[model samples]
Target chain A: MSAMSDDDRRAWAYLAAVAEPPCAPLIALAARYGAVETARMIKARKLPAGNAAVLTATQARCETDSASTDLETAHRRGARLVTPEDDEWPGWALLALDQASTSVRGGGPLALWVRGPANLGDASAVAVGLVGSRAATSYGTHVAGRLASGLADQGASVVSGGAYGIDGAAHRGALATGGRTMAVLACGIDRDYPSGHARLLEEIGDHGLVVSEYPPGTTAAKHRFLTRNRLVAALSAALVVVEAGRRSGAANTAAWARNLGRPLGAVPGPITSAMSVGCHQMIADGQAALVIDAPSVLALVEASGHDNFVRSPATPIDGLPPDQFEVIEALPAHGGLRVEEIAFSAGKPVAAVLTALAVLEVKGLVDGSSGVWRLAESW
Target chain B: MSAMSDDDRRAWAYLAAVAEPPCAPLIALAARYGAVETARMIKARKLPAGNAAVLTATQARCETDSASTDLETAHRRGARLVTPEDDEWPGWALLALDQASTSVRGGGPLALWVRGPANLGDASAVAVGLVGSRAATSYGTHVAGRLASGLADQGASVVSGGAYGIDGAAHRGALATGGRTMAVLACGIDRDYPSGHARLLEEIGDHGLVVSEYPPGTTAAKHRFLTRNRLVAALSAALVVVEAGRRSGAANTAAWARNLGRPLGAVPGPITSAMSVGCHQMIADGQAALVIDAPSVLALVEASGHDNFVRSPATPIDGLPPDQFEVIEALPAHGGLRVEEIAFSAGKPVAAVLTALAVLEVKGLVDGSSGVWRLAESW
Candidate 1:
């Protein structure tokens, strides 16, 4: 696709800098009249039905035409503007957001300010959000890390906030596994908000992607965190909450995941851990399914070959007696077959086939329900 | 009701000794022909339709005419035979068992052999089953103990197998809280199977109940434990599996609980704990709800006053200013009232009532959903 026209890119950059993310009216206006026209109308103070105070403030912020300067600085910082028109834009999840209303009234970003080596589209296609308490316990951090590593090992990207505790652990775990990870930041990708995580963020940008909706010079603000949650929820196929208190920012992300009809899972922890209360509550309320491991999370996400990750491929048939091994071989993967059919297919007597199937079932290499036998789930 | 006739008691004693528990055909025969007639036919080999091998074995076991001797010995051991016809029989739960098919094809004891101070009916009336792996970790044991103690503190009885690990801890925890507990033994109630738990079992018999189906001298057999699980599931309004492996006996009890439509809960431990695999599986499979505390368990069981147990009664409204206190006092407990209705009742302006409600909500004393306000769940 052709590169975005300079005017459109400048319009989006100006919007990203001045308008708060998920400003529904601004999103609607920009979509109705292309960003360039919308920016023009707002600048001339001729846009109808605009919030006067917000419009006035936005015009003052954009008077200097900082969009060009911001764009230049972003390029200097190795960051790029990902507009909706870009072929490399992560569109499917954002389209999903556009079609659904968010719990926090959040919607798709007009443009993503990204800094990273990974392609936005591919990075988001297989992303699974791993989020939880900033004040997570060791148990929560350990579980989050394991889940992230496991998902990454299976070639899926782990997506999370680039904050402390569980989020930081998840990113580190994925990186440690030599797998891709992305951090969707509440602040500008160019500026690490936590300061302590500057090196960590730098490593992520080098190895994976760092995404934001805010301009490069923007600092992390309170409402920005809540608004940023929608991006985290939308970018992933599923969101796994490692640990959260009853009322938490992570829970808001969970709500967005639900609003967008994404599969949401919560890892269970000891009932005594207050950190796990949100997860337990979600499970109890039927809002989230309980997930214990990476494979289970993958299974809920309906990722291809989840069952392959669920367990080691069935124990080698070579370990079994020749008869049992032959019987297992006769069992179809797609559907079960009856004893006589299996026997006929395996060139064995019905009685021998029955005995062999029994042994295989006991070994959990095969399963028989009703009168038919099939390869077990692990197999 | 009049006491059970001596002949009926002796007949039940004979059946208990000769037939394994949950022998559905045997139970059906006894129920159809009465225990006295069934015992007579089995002894004389006149029961023509009986399973030939089972009947033959039963006849051999009864050839010594051990019923009277067993009854005498049981009495000497301070135990009593509780026939189905006896008023002291725990019939309600067994009736529920009769209605539901069990996973292990288990049924209620034809006659429970009991040695305890607590009444069978009362003890089983409000019982909650707390069970898990015998190879429980300290985490499992600690959680089990807490759940048991919490349930007992609220006047609910805990029922569990009288085994080491989780079960023993549950019973001990209940006792420590001066709450009633019942130990449903796999072996004869007269002989504590583990031997190490003898003193503990004795304490249970003194303070709660020790019940079994086998005759006084019968050793605990492998099959008996599986059969005994049904009773534990049936007796409880709900079953909480604190921790279990993928295929432990506790899973069997969980199946029975499902078959019986009992509300089943699992207290989650760290996902890394192998002991919690079965619970996580159940929760992930939607077979069990995740519960974090006793009140959560009770809420799942549909027990009355569970919300009350969740937190102390709301702080007195008097602590608030007269206006806000009046608004809080106006909100009904059963269902929420509208703002105008609340205002009129509180003798305050509608705006002032709304302000008070908002403050109370932030204070965690009230809740408003839609347009109506009510006392918060925790309050």
Candidate 2:
């Protein structure tokens, strides 16, 4: 496809800055008439036949024209405007947003300001969004990192917000594996809202992508992050929540994923951990499937018709002789038990218990050390 | 309803010990002809016409009749044989087992050896089974204890196996709350399979019930535990697994619950914990709902038409102004954040953040001890 015309690009940039997203009326107007024509109508203060909703949506910022300056600032920061007219735009990924209900506050972005060499449309074809709470636990970060690395190793790109905690860990995990990742920001592409992650965002921009719908110099706010979440969900084939508190922003993203009909998976954590409350709630509400590892996340993506993946099913205990299996089951989950204790627990004679333990040890199902027998860690 | 006659009780006891249990053909024969007639036919080595399966199932134990001595021993031990003719036989609870497919090895027990003040049918009218691995983690036990205590507090009987770890914790929790708890054993009612829980079983017998399908001298075996699991599912309105390894016996009980059309629930734990693998698998496979507390378990029981329970929905971060809500969200899950850090994270001024924190603290939403602000633990 031909590159977006200069007039269309400038018009899109202007429209993006004029309204607070997601302005359903403005988005609808732009779709009916081309971005360039819509911008001309708005600038001339012309009322297009009985469309009063657009006037109310755009009146405040209609006279403002920072398109030239915004484009210049983006170019200086190594970012460029990508409209639906551009071949690199992720139109397929964002189609769901255009069709979603207004109650969900879902509306496609006018254009994306992207900073990276990777093409957004190509990267999104096999992408998964890993999102969760900024106030996350160590367990959450560990799982997020491991899952992101595994997904990247499978040749799938990872998408996430460039925030603290779970999001940062996901970005770092993908980067560590030298795989592609896209960081969609709530603020301007030039600004690092979570300043601590500035360097991480720079690294992502260098190797993958840094995207935002906000214009240059726009600051992050509560409402903007809520708006930005929809894009993260729209840009990925599937979404997995690693961890989240009851009121975490990740929950908003999850709602958006559901609204877009995306396959959603949530990682289960200790019920005692407050940070995992949202994930547990999602699973309990039947809004998400429980996912423990990367293979499970890939399975969700595969369900969306991106690729075929089959996680090797865990092998259940089988084929062990009765006594040997009893001995393995008798050993405590955390520590070793004495031979006499094992015998008592298994309801077998001490000699028989010893024989069974020996067989189990050879099969790598039990460990007998310091005269105490325990189930092998891997078992 | 009339109490079971002596002859019928003796015949049921004899039949219960004649087969290895869950013998579909023998159970069918007993149902077709009365228990007394079925016992007499087996003792005379005479099969009903066209019933070769019954002969193969009962031929080994047909010659031995311990009903007289077994009844005397049970009387001396404060146990009684409650048969289908008895008023307290829990017929409603066992109806599903009789209707289930033979492939599940689900045949109603011929007779129950019960020792307790509580009536079997009445106790099972509103019961929830809390089952899991003998080798469970501290997290699993803690959750199990809390859930059991809460369920008991709500006047629902807690049911579990008389074993160590999660089962012991659940039984003790119910006892501590002065609520009824039933222990269904894999061994004979007179025998203590897990010797460590002998005193716990005695406590349950004193306050609630100890039930078993096996004869007085029978020992616990691997296969017996598998058969015993079905009864646990049948006796309870719902089953909640606390923690289970990949091949824990609790998984078998879960399968039985599903087979019998009983509502099933599973408590979530850290994905890293091997003990929770079976629970996560159950939830992922859609075989069990994700239950976190006693109310959630109660919801499952209520779903089965046993009782009504309503868990208080968690209060999400709402009704707060944007600035205050942002400040609260900025605080980390496990620790506090400094005012300046909160301000930076929330993209608000330091003064605005301080004001929001003050209002939040007054409302008991945030803790501001040691000059750092954190969301209150309860929140």
Candidate 3:
């Protein structure tokens, strides 16, 4: 593909700053007349045929030209502007946003601000977006970390927003494993919206990628995060909600994932945990698959044409007869019990329990050495 | 329906004892030729036209007739035989067994030995079976108990296998609420397999019901529990698994529920707990709905014709604009924060945070009396 000219790059940057993201009219204008020409027409207050809506969409910021300054600020921060004209643009990944229905808010970004050595296109091609609550519980953070680490180890990049709790844990987990991770920001790529994660974001930028649609000097706002969520969902091959409250930004990302037709999964937590309320509801409503680990996440990603992934772990007595299995179940995890106690616990006749114990002893699944039967230590 | 004759009850008692349950051939024989006639034919070793499987299924016990003695024993223990001829028989509930696919083991029982004040047919008409691991954790037992109590309070009978852990918790929960509960036992109605629950069983028999297909002297065995699980599923409108290990008996009951065309639900738990493995797997595989409360269980029961049951509990800031909602979310659950701290936490501008705080104060959702904002106590 031909490289974008300097004029086209500056034009796209101006268009990006002129309107809030998801400006369909501006996107259409640029597509029809090219970024450079579209910028010229808007700057001169001239209409390109029948595109009056573009003027309305860009009316507020069209007169302010900060394209050059924004680019310079981005360069100073070691970030670069990645326009649709750039060969490194994740066009394939964001293509779904173009086809999304109106109900799913936030269309594709006009241009992205990227920082880091990792390639956005390559990383997103086989990535999993892991998002969740900033007020997540310890259990949620633990599971998120383990899942992110496992996913990274399996050669898939971990993607997440750079917030605290689950998001921070996921990014840290990927970093701990010396693997690629992408942090999509709600604010400018040069700024850490959650300042507490400033060093973490820099670490991610040094080894992975930090990306955003907002330009330099743009601060994070509630609406911007909503807009940013669409990018996280768009970039990933699949999305998993690690933990979420009833009303959480992650839920919005999950919605975007669904709207984009990306496979979605939710990790289950204790029914008593308020943090997991959204996840249970999503699974119950059939909006997401119940994912417990990294393999389950991979299963969701490869669900279309792959063989089923079984999650049941085998036990020592997997194929034992009912009587023997019951005897084994009756034995306490620790300590030992007499034959009659075992029989009573298993709800079986003494003779049957004795026979089961004999066979179990032979199979090395139980021990009767202390005149009381107990599960084998290996068990 | 007509009352079953003493002779017919005796015949059914004999048939129930002669075969290991789920004897499809004997069930067919009784359906084709009445229970009394079928018993006489089996005793005479006479085969009906082209019916030979019955001989194989009953060969070991057909000649050892215990009908008279078993009935006497049952009567002494306050247990009464209820055959298909009896008006109190739950034929409507068990009919699903006759229509079930062969892959689902266990067929309809020939007769039930019941001891209780509750009518079997009436109670089974509006019931939910609750089953789970005998080695359940406190969380599992807690959820099971709460769900049982709620279901019972809603005029639905709670049915369970009457074992320990989750099952015992369910039974106790229903009883504690002065609600009806039925214990479908793996052993004889007259005997307590888990002797520790003898008093609990007596209480259930006095106020609810104790049901079993096994004869008075019969004891519980591993296979009997599997066979009994089918009865639990068949007798209820829907079934829920509260918690279960990988090879749990509750999973078998859930399968029976699915096979019998009964709606099935499974409670979610911490992923770190092995006790919740089976439950999570069932939900992941779409074999069971994720149910966290009694209403969700009721939703499963009425899923065929009812409005969707929504499980989300709304918060005070539910309808707030993005800025206001984010500000509310940033506030600590306890105590208050200064405007600058709130702004930083919410990732919003100071002016925007002030505007949201003012609106929230007017709505009585936030308090700003001491230059510090906090969520209203009512919230």
Candidate 4:
């Protein structure tokens, strides 16, 4: 694994610049000299005479120092770095790079600082990303734990943010059940935030993996947390949100997963629960998939384990039942049909139509206004 | 409304088996010619060999009871014997009658006792049934309470078994919300069991209603409790079980509701919860409609309110996205395809395939298994 030619190292360093562009100037330097000679050209342009200001400014002070620090931390802990050119690189990460090329926010780290022997690049496997609100209900925690254990029981490794509530429960569930789990960190892997979970992290490191984009000594920052959400979404086969607030980090991860074409699954909660609103929204939207059990989740991963991502639905409707067809046909040409007219036209009594209409509303078929049912914009 | 003729009163009583059976039978001397003839020929049946077994039983029991007994208790409490001849009799109760006139295990009550002014005979009205486990989880209690309140908010009279757990929670929720609720007891209405709910029952009696089929002073028996499930199912437009065990009485009420052609609704809980297993099985078997919220329960009621129970799904499935049509058509029937395969089949790029699949899955046009995707069941 240690044997590598200069070309391989050079390609990794080049991809590092493209993959982890700190700013515009750094991107320009990488673009100019193809990484290896960029420092010289940048120095020649910005030297008191010939100093690579763009390349040296970032790599010299940040990349070099960070690498040394990371290496020192890595040496003390026997960890290593894996870049795009590494034999251990997964195609899924490369797919992320391609996606980042089209997006402004970008994909992930140029080099992942890893602390365990996880051949994520190995064919036919799944990484389960379980996330939820920090203030999850006990029910949510229980569901997360069950999903984690079930997925592990099926030989799938669990991946989650190491936060409390659903995240904590998921990791602990895997650990307690003697299963593999990975804790992807926004902060440096060594400096664990929410101090109480250090033991859990240590256990995960022992049997699973803990990898981060940031240098080992870097402190946890809120922005870093969100930025790392893409990695959590990208590295896994599917993202399962056990619980989420209306605007939660779990929801953010789900959105990214959807945008990245990764499968997204969410556990349903009580409709009245404010914490589950995000999940409801995701399921409502054409984004996340809905699963009630771990088998449903595993079924998804196993079916697409060999591929980068699974295909979408292949039908017209979730397959509308007969009554739904009637109500839909009863709607007016432009505006929604009055509930009265719909009932009459569908030949269903008024009460019967009303219930069908509500189901239609949730499914985003007919939008109701002033007691009339019209087709939804989404429909 | 009080313009009932003598014939009408007799007709009502005859339907409820209150005075006499509809069929003419050999009376002691004349024949048992239903309530009509009982009104005209009370003397036809001498004291012995009358078809009024229930009536004779009631009358003789009164003789054994002294002035200081339950009869006095009933009189003091102002409880009235609401024979089916009364204008306030609930027509919904007729649903409990054996279709073939078979000897019902629990036949029509000798007389229904009443203490409330709410008319069960109103055409534009409803009774909502809430039932579940005696040993329910907090989640169950919470859902039952909210569902009951929602029904009451929608102008329904809540009906439930006067049992512990979900039933009590529903009753309390309805009472706290200033809604009409009825506690149907297996024992005499005055008697309270599962003593912890005595205060709750008293409150229901004061604010809503407490009803019993048993004559006053009857103690509750285990068989009677099971026997009581029919009234809970028959008396309402729809029955919603908040949480039920595999063998809970709630399941009995649900089965009866289904068999009676009433819409049956069930609240879903965490799949891991044993309490929710009954609910899950019910939904899966199509025995009970899944109610996600108050609105869904209301929808079920509205759909089931009329004589014809099978209606369009309260929720309609939105059709598939336009762009996904080509993708859907191109999908092989074998199973879910990898993203690239679908994109190639549809003559689209990987990103387009991903986006379309997400939207399609949301529309329920597709179901993506682990890494495999396929047409949804509906499709």
Candidate 5:
């Protein structure tokens, strides 16, 4: 529907042949010498290094053989060559890519075939990747939905690898909240790898975008999922693992997230649930924060200066004076003590303690039961 | 059976009126004035200041009613005044008694009704008090029994209030293993408040010892349970909560132990069970160490110099060379990689890898499943 560039089309075509990751490596090499030049060098040198990339391009051509009628056809696909260093390329996502086994050489990102209006890796736009096991339990689905919807309600975009269970739940949560979410697939944009999530995948493309490192017509494999996780990790400042078993793929993603020093959040679950094991280990080892709610997750990320998200708990207490805390401090951990006892300890006059207690009661800072006082439910 | 003293008889008569804990304040006060003179000064003063020795004598008397006879009567009973400064007195126990209350005096124990061949408060002997829910599940009972037996096996004396559930389980564990134990009661030594366990209580008194702060004929009251917790906390260098629910009474004992600066151990359990909630909360807040086995509990106490108990691996590797470590390092978090891979990474030959794997596997450092390897346990 739009005018496309010839060089971009040629780059896209070249990417079609690459079947391997360190796709970044090939792309970087291509960027340095141009795809045609690099391809020529590879074949001439009979280098195994470029074999993966060349094979991928060849496969894409095979799958879309009749689709690209001629060389001119490549120029009309509306695609472009966006390398890791491109000004348009997200600097944030490099956090994910950086963790991968980069090309033994200096190359990274063969070439990224990102197609979306929203910058996939924009730091200003809050993006969080919600990931977990594909064989997720209902609890996992519930948590993923709740956390994603919460992030979206705060105007943050959600990202995930269009898979089953957690990934789908995250996308649906954002969509249901009337927010945008992107799906970074392991296969080509034109090919939904799972095939079962086709409808949801298409819906995401319609509302947000579906991105892939592979060019058009490429299929996905198990290895692709691991590679896919990196994109999910790199695209967001914080990666929250909603649910993951001990050996779940989500653990790998979490490992990558942690290695990048990114803020990681994991929800706590019953200790007996296998899905909760990885999260427990993560929280136990101090690799993740135990986030139980949306506000909490947002607060953790914002506190990290990860995405610059902000929260203003709109209420009288948000602007309350320090003196007001006297009421809360007086509340006992073992329910409540007598008013006189609280007043005596607070070092305030009986009338003053009563009046402040009343005011805090109205403001929800204190819950007065009979003559005793306890902390209000704002916590 | 032994000589009698008029002072011992009168001490017992006076003890008949006061309860265990208040006895601490009384004896501490009595000892302050030198003999009963100082104790009377403290008892007469009540809430006000008195001789410092009242602190010691009161705590000792509170520990156990003064045998209702003269010094000769106490001597006949094979018991004598064990003061705070007594060389046989446990220094670690004094640490707990010091914090009986906040804003109000809390820790002082008037006196202890102790009768044992071993100095009841000997610092050299390790004592761990195991307390938990009166209604323990099988899991709690199993863990308590194993932990108690393990401690007993290490020649550590077990101390408990001798209540039901965890306490009863611990005593049984020690008895089954033929190890020593002490029962500190809230009622008179001659009276068993829980009639259901009267015979068991008697057996313990005969086999080990039974102590109470109340004098002869004093009955156990609800308030006495709280006073009883202090004794449990004070007698041991560390207190381990085997099973505790939200707001469980065991938490109170743990809090007391903590306030005394004694190490606390809490066994982790399935979070879904209400019984494990308090323990989880304790471990979560760093108030207690997460102990799954006897070694962990012993490790913590020993580190604090309570007991020098350590458990070496069944098959010790001892100063292994690099070649052996190579196989150990290559295992998965919970599984083993192939010996070839391990050896390859270690820069050794396949034969060396197999030999190392076999040796380590037999020693429990590595486990060979299929052709892969993993650590025996996650610790």
Candidate 6:
């Protein structure tokens, strides 16, 4: 947990306090000369090769604010700074983000300020993000809550932003199910942005985790939500957009998920509802798979995983009706058999054979013709 | 208009009277020996090279009933025999079926017994089939009706069976809109099997067409409905399954549409609705596109047409907000520019530029980063 030296932790905290996450120049310089040296150089008014505007701004802010005081404030709130170098850092997701094309300057967070009992590494290993519109319909909320609960019950951590509608429902669903749920905030973990979900966020911090890139006391800005979306996408094995308007923060997270090659699943709502338009559009464009419920979501996760999951058809010969299976056996592969022939071969009445054949045809087990039937090619 | 001679027409009419539509043996024999010659052979109790069981049964029935009498009955019922040799055969669809592998012996109808003022060729040239479950929910019927109405309004003929639920709704919608609609019946066009839809079927004959493969007085058998689905799929430019239970007849039509390589679409409903499971499964299997409304359905039809239709993005330069368009124009192709740089180039306030960039990002026209933005690759 104390892999970072005292000076190194302070330097990382100082940069995090003054600068926004994914500061490209700071990240690059930190990679090259380490966070302690990068911090000193920025404070000394040194310039990078390109885009020093962000660095200059951070340095100006550093002149007025105390980085040590910011770190102490975060600690008082029971939050700990987790940099890439920290032993407790969820490196798998964040490290993968380094190779992704992100909306922010750095591919992902320079460091995560987290407060919770849940282990970042273990919880994140099987995370499924549940995000959607703040103005989600009751249908959307119900669907989100159920999916989140199912995902949590399946031992996958449910990650989401601490917004009002879908996000709040998802977190509450997980907690209600007695499962772990994490909230990734746009503002400081200590300051709940919606102002209404303070209790919910507090409970998340107590039972699961509340994570942020910004230090304590930082306010959530409009752009910060968009910037923080990449984190949500990056931290999960898969991202499920429960319901989103055509243009919403949820769409942005979807874009990030796609750009990162994460498996994207969208819960389909009624097409008549404007809330589900983005989802339908995504499915139409082949950007997301239509996921109706929790089982489908898990199926998508399994199929998209490195193992190459293949689903076995629900109907097998043993599962078919006895008469239908007998009829299927009576038919030929290359051509077909008349119902009378099938009846005689299966030792069934002609009318009974016809009925069985009809049911089998509907089940896609056989094809029926003019009093003739055959095994379907799919069989 | 009279391509078939009197003898040839009578022979084709005789075959349509006793044999089912898509009787493969009859189709093959007719193709080999012409309708008159095929009829003569059947009358002599002769057989084809393969699968003569259907033809033998039809010939045995023909021994007692006269072919001329059957034609007289159909003619009295206001139904004319339209064969492949005739000018009004509507052969484009059935000819395409000649290339398809179907469940019945023949790939498609050898002759269509049609009763209506509408010309089959002209009416069917731009047809769109809207079919679904007979036991549909109100939601399914509503969507089917609206989509059918929209399709008819766009100068495309709406096609469906004269059954209850979604099919009836589709036909009624087209007729209510004062647009062309044709019902492809599983039973004889003269005998509306549902009885409840008799008036609706009669009205369709008045305005559009009531078409069938069977001659007058044939009943709608369960297998006939399944066999009838291929006609619905083959005769349309595209087929949309509005709402279908997992094993409904609409799913069979969807399967036929896919097998025939026709563009297929399915309307998305509430996921909780069991009726939508078949439609959703089709979408998940990549057998159909998710179409929300009639416009989207038409859009798919256009996109899937022979011209290889490419959609023009909804938002062009003129369609975008001036500031957003300017910000997009200010972005670099190779890399990205900071918000300040974009603001300077676009001659707008930094805050205004940021706001515009956010909108543009949502529009998927531009990519915004940590204070930097660029044109999205998709744009």
Best by DockQ: 3
Better of 3 and 5 by DockQ: 3
Alpha carbon lDDT at B93, candidate 3: 78
Give each model a TM-score: 0.77, 0.76, 0.76, 0.60, 0.58, 0.77
Model 5's CAPRI class is incorrect
lDDT of each: 0.80, 0.84, 0.84, 0.65, 0.63, 0.78
Each model's DockQ score:
0.58, 0.58, 0.59, 0.13, 0.07, 0.46
TM-score of 5: 0.58
**How does chain B score by TM in each prediction?**
0.76, 0.78, 0.78, 0.66, 0.66, 0.76
User: For residues A89-199, what per-residue lDDT tens digits would candidate 6 score against the true structure?
Assistant: 775666446545334443667788899989887788788889999999999888889988998899888999989999999999898898999899988887977889989
Q: What interface-residue Cα RMSD does candidate 2 give after superposition? A: 0.5
> Local error of candidate 2 at A215, Å?
1.2
Worst ten-residue run, lDDT, model 1 chain A?
A: A304-313
Count steric clashes of candidate 1. Answer: 0
The per-residue C-alpha lDDT of model 6 at residue A16 equals 83
lDDT of 1 by residue, A1-379 (tens): 2378888899988877767667655665665567898788777777766456447546656565679988998899888999876877886657557545343556678788888889988888778999999999999999999999999998889999999999999999999999999999988878976899999999998899999988888889888888788888888888899999988889999988877667889988988889999998898888888988888888877842221111113346633545676577667778899898787665567888988887888888887875688888884
Candidate 1 on B83-180: residue-level lDDT in tens? 76777776656654654533356556778888877888778877899999999999899989998999999889999999999999999999999999
lDDT of 2 by residue, B159-247 (tens): 99988989999999999999999999998899986998889998999999999999888899998898899999989889999999999
Cα displacement (angstroms), candidate 2, residue B37, comes to 5.3
Give the candidate order by descending DockQ: 3, 2, 1, 6, 4, 5
- Could you give candidate 6's per-residue lDDT for residues B1-379 as a string of tens digits? 4766778888887777656566655675675567887777777777655546656557546665456876787788777888877777776666446545344433778788888888988888788889999999988888888888888898888999888999999999899899999899888877976999989998998899998887777888988887788888888878899999889988888877766667899888888899999888888888889998778888867765522111133335433544566577668777899988787655456888889988888887777654567788884
lDDT of 2 by residue, A214-305 (tens): 99899999888988999998887889999999888899998888877788899999999999999999999999999998889888887766
lDDT of 3: 0.84
lDDT string, candidate 3, B1-379, tens digits: 2566778878888998998888876876785567888899999999765567779889999999899998999888777888777888886678667545255466688888998889889889889999999999999899989999999999899999889999999999999899999999999998986999999999999899999999988899988998899899999888899999999999889888877778889999998999999999999988889999988899888873221111113356644665687689779989999997787665466898899999999999999997799889986
* Candidate 5 wrongly placed segments (more than 4 Å): A1-6, A9-19, A23-89, A93-212, A215-225, A240-250, A265-280, A290-296, A308-379, B1-89, B99-104, B114-227, B239-251, B265-284, B306-379
Write the residue-wise lDDT of candidate 4 on A34-64 in tens digits: 4445444433444222224344445444334
